[model samples]
Target: MLLKIGLVVIGVVILYVVVQVLLYKRDMKKTKEDLLTFVTKNKKDVSVTIIENDDVVLEWNADQKTPLASTVKLVVLFHFVKAVSSGAIKLEEKVALSDIERFYIDRTDGGAHAYWLEVNDFSEHATLLDVAKGMMQFSSNACTDYLIDRLGLEKINDQMKQAGLTEHDELMPLTPMILWSAYVSDRRRDAFKKMSGVSEEQYKSLMNEIFNIMKNDPEHKKALEEKMKKKNLLGWRIQSLLTQKLTKSTTNQYAHFMKLPG
Candidate 1:
């Protein structure tokens, strides 16, 4: 009777273990199905990955690349915090708004400039911390550019590399002023194309020559005007473009490298 009872007990233990394994597999399958369904219904041309406890639970097209958009600001913020923690910059440090900085703000749309215009003091002094806050909170382009100048773009990029951020490769060279200038210039070019009868190639060539001269020659302003006159592109709109110059990870690899450690 004792031997029979022991054998029965062993059989019951095996049955319990088998049931647990089955349940675990079932749950995992359900979770994957739900995730796929969610992505299909909610996301449009987006790559997604879900990680838990250092493991990728679900992933789809995770290797695909897409525009970082405002998400890139997180990189800037990450570097800024590191700077503060390392005693490279102080929170109370005051930065007087330079003429160039002010110019960028005045000319660029929807960035630090807009925020500054709303709340800058009579003396135009703002702390380093405040500028960082403005960059994150207000998405201020002016503040971002200023901080980039202060921190040195190369150093920030180096830090990103050392941290092994694959996403940073596409997002490097974060120059807000240049970006704004290009944006405004592109719009102006589009407008020119629509409003003028000149051939697109001819117009582009003329603009390139004038910009090249402006960069290399001290008399670029005059030269620009002359070129524009020759091409019949000279106008307030073209001039404004110069002023505006002021104008992702794969499943397992992504999970390992993409997340920021606390």
Candidate 2:
């Protein structure tokens, strides 16, 4: 009777293990199905590329040149790492929060920079590496813009080509988009009008002109911040235009960018 009970106990344990395995597989299948449903629902609005081991494992709108918006920071982040590796930017370098604020506007960026400030009690300054972390971690536009200035826009674009990212558009400063709302000297002061009427090349030139002042002149940078702080200029309407206009790249090239050796 004791021997029979022990065998029954062992059989029960094996049955429990098998049931758990079956449940786990079912859950995994459900998760994949859910993810596919979500992606299919939003595929019209998004570009997605997933790469593994230098292979195009998945892609949607991969060849379409799409505006990167904040994801442009990925290219900038790549350049920052390259600069550090080449001994150009010291990781421990001191950076003033005041200087970063020059590029920051109060309401833009969905409070990313503000959130970074609240959590990091750096007093007056933080290191370059820390700021870079905030760029990726918090999506801080201020940190991104500051690093763009520090890293040099020309060099950033050059490195994009060096990385064989043929689909990339030129890297430029942010915060200038708000200035296009009847506040600037351009003919198409209204953002939507410019989008509707101007050629792609013209719009790009306009952004370049705005960024040049921010790049070369400190006073213009301060002026830009003040204007952007106003933030009441129907800016949300230009979301689609921004993705098409600003520093666009194909999902394909960015997929390749992901495969690069750091």
Candidate 3:
């Protein structure tokens, strides 16, 4: 009777293993088919990854890179969270309203025009987490600009480089007038100076104010200092759709991968 019990236990174990293997294979096949079908259906290119059992499976054009658009916010969120986790910045730390933030809020009519604003009052106070959340949830351009100003554009770009995303642009907040000129003119630095009509000395002074706000956070300050000493300025690489190859389609693949079968 004991021998029979041992055999039964072994049989159950074997059955369980077989079931698990079958499930895994089925899931993988479904995923691959879904990806291929989506790619074929959509005209755009994309990358996909699956994580299971603490292992990552990537299906993508390793050499291909694309514009992140709002996806870049994920990088910002990661750095912000890391700063908080490392005790470099506090979630509850109060950030005083700057003229730029106030101007942006006012220009947009208390954020009613903008999705990022939680409160209409310019006097409304907020914590770092509030700003961070607004940035991620709303993809608030204004909030992102404010945070970038506070964090220092150079530092943010440096963090991006460290995170292994080298092909990302760090756009600093500028006036519409300046933005237009910068966009149209190849001589950006000179065009900026001409558009602002600020003397070199005055420009330096303005930069000082911006830098001062960034220095308020210890982590931001440290990152700024480190960036200044670095030889290479953080920059993004431009990729053209016509020049590159994409094995998978982005639009359909993303939808199919995320969608549940009804």
Candidate 4:
């Protein structure tokens, strides 16, 4: 009886792994055009534009405000390059690994932070250059928040304007999506209450407020961290609210950004 039960469990595990592999392979076979068609047609909540040689090639919801999500990291990368070129920040500047780890919220980033650390194989610390590489290459939010602390948020937002990205929303720290959701779970306030009253200035302020606590106030930060660690806070409602708040820009603006001088 034991042997039979163990065999059944093993078979189930094997089947699950095989299904996952097949799905991954199927997704890998999809071309850029296939992806675009699928997203634009099926995911009707998308804003996309394709520009070639200063000419508009394709567009959908071109002028509509679209959430940037992780794409906001591109702005960070652009600014980091400019800072290095202008002799503002050195590539060799070393940062303690613990400092970077502090900003990392586990499980929210789809394991990006852990994966970056694994691939880089750094022990206690890494250079600013490697950190920046992790930020762009791995899309690590931890790596980004570290840079944001080192480089002022105001300066980063100024890069968008300097690059003629008038439509781009202000850059805010990314970890708050998880932390603030946890706050809502603790019954401090609901998602709608938090989002509805927030203007651009108020939104930016709240983001900075959370980020400051993470950097400075250990006890408060610990409480928030415990909330995240102990409970699952993100629900459909908070996610919907976040989708509205997480940086937004038009499809045309995104394409325009790609055309800017690097």
Candidate 2 regions off by >4 Å? 1-38, 41-44, 185-191, 212-231
Question: Stretches of candidate 4 above 4 Å error?
Answer: 1-26, 31-44, 188-192, 229-231
Give each model's clash number. Answer: 5, 1, 0, 0
Q: Given candidate 2, what's the lDDT at residue 87?
A: 76
Q: Model 2's lDDT to the true fold?
A: 0.71
Cα displacement (Å) at residue 15, model 1: 54
lDDT of model 3 at residue 177? 18
Tell me the tens digit of each residue's lDDT in model 4 across 1-262: 3344335334533543454455368677779999778786766687779998899999888888878887787777777777776778877898999898878776777777887798779979899977876676666888988898788889999878988888888888888656775554565346557666777887777788888877777577778878756654566676778878888888888788877654
Over the stretch 1-262, how does candidate 1's per-residue lDDT look in tens digits? 3344334333533543454455357665567789778778867556767888877787767666544544455566667767766778877888776522532423334344564446555266778866765565555665665676577767876876777765544333223212222322335466444434444454444444433333345354444333444444435775444332211223333455447652
Rank by lDDT, descending? 4, 2, 1, 3
What is the per-residue lDDT of model 2 for residues 224-251, given as tens digits with 9 covering 90 to 100?
5555444544455665556555777888
For residue 63, give model 1's deviation from the true position in Å. 1.8
Output the number of the lDDT-best candidate: 4
Global Cα RMSD, each model: 18.3, 13.7, 17.1, 12.1
Give per-residue lDDT, candidate 4, residue 63.
Answer: 86
Show pairs that collide, candidate 1.
Answer: 111-140, 112-140, 112-141, 181-245, 244-247
In candidate 2 the C-alpha lDDT for residue 185 amounts to 31
Give the runs in model 1 whose Cα sits over 4 Å from its true position: 1-44, 99-112, 116-122, 170-258
